[model samples]
Target: MTNNMKNVFDSSNTYGMAKTFVLISLYALLIAIGMHKGVKIFLYIAGISGALLLTYEWFKMDRPSIPTFFIAPLLFLIYVLISPGTFLIDARLAGRFACALFAGVALQFFFSNATYKVLLSQCAALLTTLFLGVTYACIWAPEMFDDRLILSYRNPHQLAVAGAFSIFTLFTYLSIFSKKKQLLVYCLFVIIGTAIFMTVSRSTSLGLLCAFAAYILFYRSKHLIKIVVAAGLLGLIAFSILPATQQQRLIDPFTAPLNDRTIKQRVGIWYTALQGFDEAPILGHGLRAYSDYDSDYKEAHRAEMVDKNILIIDSRWAHPHSLYLGSLFGWGIVGTLLLIGAFIPAFRHSSGRIKTFLFLMTFFSLGYGLTELRIKSDDGAFILFFPLGLAYGSILFEHLSQKNKTTSEYPIQTKPCITKILTLLN
Candidate 1:
């Protein structure tokens, strides 16, 4: 994993820098593995590494940006702290969120200055790695693509979301920032795009579409027709390649009985979660409280509904499948608003390729969250925070770059408050 990140980051000690880069890269790659259990190990590694780095930096001369974006995580913590019962009550859920949050915040400082390019480059490489894994899985065990390219994910939705995000990253950078490698980037885009379509995750697929459409509208609406036509053709070709039975499975989600497949089952799940929201409309019961609520109360209700044949007996998975609804249950209206704090300002003062990438992620998350509890789960949380940190880091680094440019143009007026403070201390 670290070798994949070689030459992307550097430091005074070339050997140590390479080692650190490898460690960080490998940790990120581990999280990107798409499996539920495997992602956790890297979570601790990243969170702990960030913690130690920040602790040491607290006393060192070299300092990182203030991370104004970190207020989002801070607010989340505060909201969790004042929730109904004791902190220990929601320790399991709360602890996971805390570690993920720390890992994200720490990342904002990890690749400092203009090293964000390295991070984005690393993302493209990681995506390539993931796609290669899927390719191998498909050829070695074709069954992996039976329902959807399950890849290493517990389900297709996870793979779908990750691949979609990777597409957004690759496209944003290659198109807007580094247009030098057009053909190669387009090929990579097609490969990952194929993987996303194969996932058969309708919500994630639509989320990617909506995000891409939005990107066009915001920037290149004039060529919308061409883009749409090309995309439609591509989709048709991808679908045509699917086996007849697999195509039926893809269509069943839309036409099948509500309980038997996915869509209707989702409707039932959403209805149950909304019921819980009604019970506590202000501050939610607590983090991960939905599981117990569903088991004790909603489950019995669903079972009764199932017996009456009014609804299907689709009570397999857990969580309310919607980030908006998840927030409504876990944090309530006010807490949900606070949670948004963690995301909204990430694009503050950003523009061009960076802005597009962040916007893609932001809109994608909202769309994906509609039918998936992306914010609560480990894979979802890790994937989201890592990119978010990149977005925020880009913003901070850009700000610094512009400031330096401005300062260089006018070097006499003021050195910088830092220089003034240092002079005083000296």
Candidate 2:
């Protein structure tokens, strides 16, 4: 390829950087617009447009090594086709998932040794920390200042998913940009960590704690203890400052009964899920189909009638609480396996530290999925895959670059276990 044509997809050129900027902008816009139907429609359009442009740029240069990259979407597609009469078959929902999968596939094609090297280096960490600090303020300050735009922490699932994304973004920054100034970024991370706590998402809280431990153990920050302390103090202050209703939700016991209901009433959803699993133990009812049955369970158990309009809310929010349950309920064993398979690549090229981080995320995802359907959330989608992709790209690029080096002056040792494992996975 001529230098001019090559520059369009050049690893060192501005094209990738510009695309990243556009992608980030679009993400911020989508989040800012929130979850209204109109906003979701616009988001699907924007997501597809970006994916198309990135795809064009990618195939014009490199091709993906594996076609099994289609596994995730294929599972989702099967669920949609087979789901029962009342399934919430929203085209926008399918579009969002498809768009996310495309983005990841396109990323692999575009990710190069040079890009991976830059992402893994210390400078990347500084940039990430800076971005987190700014976004943290952007999300928090609006809530702090304006009464009309009162931060809706009503949706714990969304809060947890958003918090997970923020935590991943912050860690990615720290991992890539480890410098003296980057230490200051950890302080900012503590602040972002505090905001996560304020969201009061039990799953998110757990995920944030897991991420914190990973950062401390792997990144080895000397000031980790102080950072932890600051996080606790901030959590206390945030709780102390919120309105009484919000505070109750924040401090309520996990087992507390909702709406002053009976134990059966409170646990009705779980019981129904268990029963449903028995009916179709292997394949289950398909994604989002659980709530079609949930409506009947609620009507039977509910003393007072729930709004008919709100009945479909759970359908929009379907996915059994446990990731294991969700897997079984949504796609049966086959679907669950495909979902798990999506993450196996994270284990192939990464080091012990990165693997631990990825596994912790998977663990948290399993825990979070047990009670919430996070896969539908935009924030959750981004959180689940981006770090894995970045780390994988970083390690793979590093390995490829070292192989290309022709000098005896410097040689890098490849981990034997990693080498053998990646060979098999590939």
Candidate 3:
């Protein structure tokens, strides 16, 4: 047997079981993204099963190297339990967070394995194709809300976020394919990009643009300048080709009275969130505490709008629209710092495609968080955390590879099984 093939299949039977469950969790995650129904059931299957199996595997290790970031979730959970605003705690919300965290950690283990990393890349490509096909079907017969595209997902923003995530995944996996397959992936990008544009989500568009720019900057490809110029030209072409209404919306959404009012209301909520933050700067309000003040913020914002001669249409505030603001308000400064700090090690250690992928995810998430909350939502957690776990997994795997002096890098044609899968995909 070839050395690489042995490396791929030499893992203990228990670790193999862990890998199998992790793959199932990821597949379940993709299904959850498209259907959105039975999300909790799927999440539990993914999180609990993978977490338990991975923990077993960890215990079996002679000297397991636990990544520092894993501690962040446990610490955050403790803070949630002990911090002020216990009354505001939502058990379901906490449970969802736990599920996502465990699933993410399981993914970290999956990526750390050389064989599973390649398998994941292949699985992602195949599942993404199926996902985009479904999205295209939905787009073809879209349920439009005020000329906005809502496909499968109840909210247009949800569809947009899904598209953005698919695009990111496709881009990250693009390198594994031959040039012909790469062209096909680019076509998929066009379809996803068109769907995103149809959503008319200003924040998502901006976030995607920022993500692309970050990718180009950090990727440092030989054709960097050419890629930038091409992107600019493509942007202009896309804008010109968009429907007049969408163009107007993209250029200046405030030109429409409804859009103007919506923006104003969002601003008011953000201001109110800041006020909440100021009230409890240290510990902050508990998780979902923003909901407690939702009615008050809406009434106060309604009065402010009335004073400005603006119409009050929808005055309901569920949660702060911004992730950063929500984090601050929910956990206060200490928790927020811990949350951000957790990513520092992963960012520092990750390299190559993993680093690029991490940067794109971080940039897009931060940019999108400016106008919307994602981490708090189930779909958002899957989108944000799973890939994050994969990136960290790569980092940890690299460390192990170096320590053990095994071939950790993804081997293209070393394993016949993987090669056959790639061939089918190509």
Candidate 4:
């Protein structure tokens, strides 16, 4: 085990410098994502810079290759470019998605050889800091949107999604850390969980529930029962502590079925999105198609509600509420399949721990997507793709390590340009 750990870090100085830059950029990206405002520009700059650097380093290496995980985003970008009804904005959105995937791939590729203990420790620390910042904001500079927690720039649902993702990550990676680190994660988990509840986002709550279920089913751990019980008690305590209105909001869907305006509105938006899908079943109506059919949506929404004797309401939603439905409406069945195909390679090649992590991420994303469009934009796209990229990179690294062993060949070394510069500085 010691030898294997040594082998994992045995890279040339040039590769080490590149890895340093990539890791810094990744940390920057995470900070940007967790910020409320004025940091997204940093995310864009860091993401693009990291992607470009990784691409250059990748091509400079011998036998440079693109991972199968990256192919789907590339293809999706192409489809968005040439497909009918796509505008410049649509193409731009597609470009962002592609960039995000590549960014994730780069992050993981560079960190591929690092032990989970090292990788997850950095992640846990950064995430805990972010949650602490959010917690402070919630207390000292609270921003409320419709009685739900919102940061300066993000909406309630977005905050909820971020909190949910952070919690899911900490939970999945819990077992990899030491006892002290585990305790910190538990505290961070409570902080993030309370924040999520304050967001009053039922969809995100549901997603968290689904992620927990997936973790229990697939994540092999000796302390699973203890972890589950602790989480349950924490969750119950958090819920109990929320303001009455927030608690009521969380349970509103279950307690007051007909009084849920959001549900009714979503049903209407979904109907309209599906109607658009029927028109272009193969390729859908292109990006942002849901908004284009506003008149149709309003009509369908009113008619649908009339049948149930529900009060008719006006809606001007920019995108379909559901990610799956949005994809079906905008990209159609073929494009959606392409999107799904991107993950197959990662799942095929990754280890059991990675597979479990990916499964939990996917399950949570899908569950959250049932009522929100997450991956279509920059913030949410990064949240979904970055970890996935890490998994893919690890898989590729493992494969290469094994192949080198079988052939009795030394691992390929990178050029020393960055190494030379660092040496000059030192």
Residue pairs clashing, model 1: 2-22
Please write out the lDDT profile of model 3 over residues 309-337, one tens digit for every residue.
54444556668888888888878898788
lDDT of 3: 0.66
- In TM-score terms, candidate 4 sits at 0.78
Candidate 4 differs from the real structure by a C-alpha RMSD in angstroms, to one decimal, of 6.6
Better of 1 and 3 by TM-score: 3
Per-residue C-alpha lDDT of model 4 across residues 346-404, encoded as one tens digit per residue:
77777765666677778888788888886667777766665666666566556545433
Error of 3 at 414 (Å): 22
Which candidate has the highest lDDT of all?
3
| Model 2 spans > 4 angstroms off | 1-94, 108-160, 175-180, 210-266, 298-322, 350-361, 385-426
Winner by lDDT between candidate 2 and candidate 1: 1
Which runs of model 4 end up more than 4 angstroms from their true locations?
Answer: 1-21, 64-70, 84-89, 113-146, 151-153, 220-233, 296-315, 399-426
Candidate 1 vs candidate 3: the lDDT winner is 3
Score candidate 1 by TM-score against the native: 0.76
Q: Residue 76 deviation, candidate 3, in Å? A: 3.0
Question: What is the per-residue lDDT of model 1 for residues 123-242, given as tens digits with 9 covering 90 to 100?
Answer: 554466566776797679767666667666667677677667667756765644555577877877787778778777778876887788788898899999999999889888999988
Off by over 4 Å in 3: 1-19, 34-37, 62-70, 81-83, 87-91, 111-146, 221-225, 253-259, 297-314, 398-426
Each prediction's TM-score versus the true structure: 0.76, 0.60, 0.78, 0.78
Which of candidates 2 and 3 is the stronger one according to lDDT?
3
